[model samples]
Target: MAPGVGGAITGAAAGKFFSWLLESERARPPRVFVSFDFDNDQQLKHLLIGQTKRQNLPFSVVDGSLKEAAPEPRWKEAALKEIRRCDVVVVLVGRYTYKAPGVLAEIAMARSEGKPVVQLIGSRSLGYTRVKGAGKVLAWTQDNLTKLFGND
Candidate 1:
């Protein structure tokens, strides 16, 4: 075989190998617990969630859009349970997040459970306040999402 042909075959084989590796990494979508101030940040949270779904990102939000109809104590219990099941927690930090007791509690629970926490600050106007146990605090963007969840 010609040397150029041999080099081409080798390059094709390497490309195929890397492609397979990337696919394998994407196969197991991580379970994510998203903690946000539902009352104040719902729209932004929904937008992020929608983008993830539309883009077929490599992660699943364990907490669906279900409202917490239960009382505060029971709701916290349920939220903690969901957080425990997830591999990571994404906290949507907005201006009202510090004032939202439930959001703070969720972040605390995630920390107690040893789940990795990724904080997504919705706006610069909100002023960034790092969550107690956040592993990363980043602006809301697809590139930041990729940083947390890996390239899709």
Candidate 2:
């Protein structure tokens, strides 16, 4: 092989290898599937999502869209699929969250999929109901959220 051609090929290979290594090293934020009371706390869910955009939190909320899934069976299936895709599940606890059937089902699905569940207190007011089997709720905060998702 010509000396110039050999050097050029080796340099190109090294550059490609370096790029690949960097790409693997750069870990994207965790994919979070947020489960919230759909009927009574849609606004709370929106607010949480808004924080993700504005604060640039260390997690991306996966749009499971289980609420729109047709029929009860399909909804469960969709929930399971979405939960499987996410690295963790974040349940937004509201005043009526404990009674929400959809939220309850989603939480169960998340558990079945073996995803880590992080419950956040959605309402600041007292007397908010916490969902059962969803673990204890933590006060929502940027640092808290960052740490939760950063655990990976």
Candidate 3:
């Protein structure tokens, strides 16, 4: 092997190694999309939002009420787009949430996209209809969420 050529190869390797090292160190976390029945309860939305912020998870809450205008049915398409882009989908189900059309649509879309869907049945028992097709159902509490997703 040529001595000078060896130095060039080694220098190139070191430069590439350092670049990857820095990139990994500063990498952004994956996003999670939170879906819940907007008509269900204010307290649930507030708690979920607070938990997301506290954990520093990149996320967007899909609440139609927060927007300035009424949501079109196509908004489901937009919302699912966000869900597909995210690494995880968190479905919070209260009594009202389970019965809400929007929440049902969101859950089905998320499942269709093959995203990891975690169903949180909070403080409420779901009727057989609501529980029938759920792939994974977990406790609706914050602690259970931490368990499923891993605490940050």
The top-ranked prediction according to lDDT is 2
- Winner of 1 and 2 under lDDT: 2
User: In candidate 3, how many Å is residue 22 off?
Assistant: 14
Full-model lDDT for every candidate: 0.79, 0.82, 0.66
**Residues 5-30, candidate 1, lDDT per residue (tens digit)?**
98899999999999999888667777
> How high a TM-score does candidate 2 get?
0.77
Alpha-carbon lDDT of model 1: 0.79
lDDT string, candidate 2, 34-141, tens digits? 888777778877888899999867779887865544788987788888899898898998888888888888888888888788789987785687678887679898
TM-score winner between 1 and 2, please give it: 2
Ranking by TM-score: 2, 1, 3
Instruction: Return the lDDT, model 1, position 13.
Output: 100
Estimated TM-score for each candidate: 0.73, 0.77, 0.63
- For model 3, how does the per-residue alpha-carbon lDDT over 1-152 read when each residue is reduced to its tens digit? 88799999999999999999978744645456777666655566678778777774443444433343246666776787787777677776676665777666777887898887777766554442243344578766656655665524
Tell me the deviation in Å of residue 99 in model 3. 2.4
Best by TM-score: 2
Between prediction 1 and prediction 3, the one with superior TM-score is 1
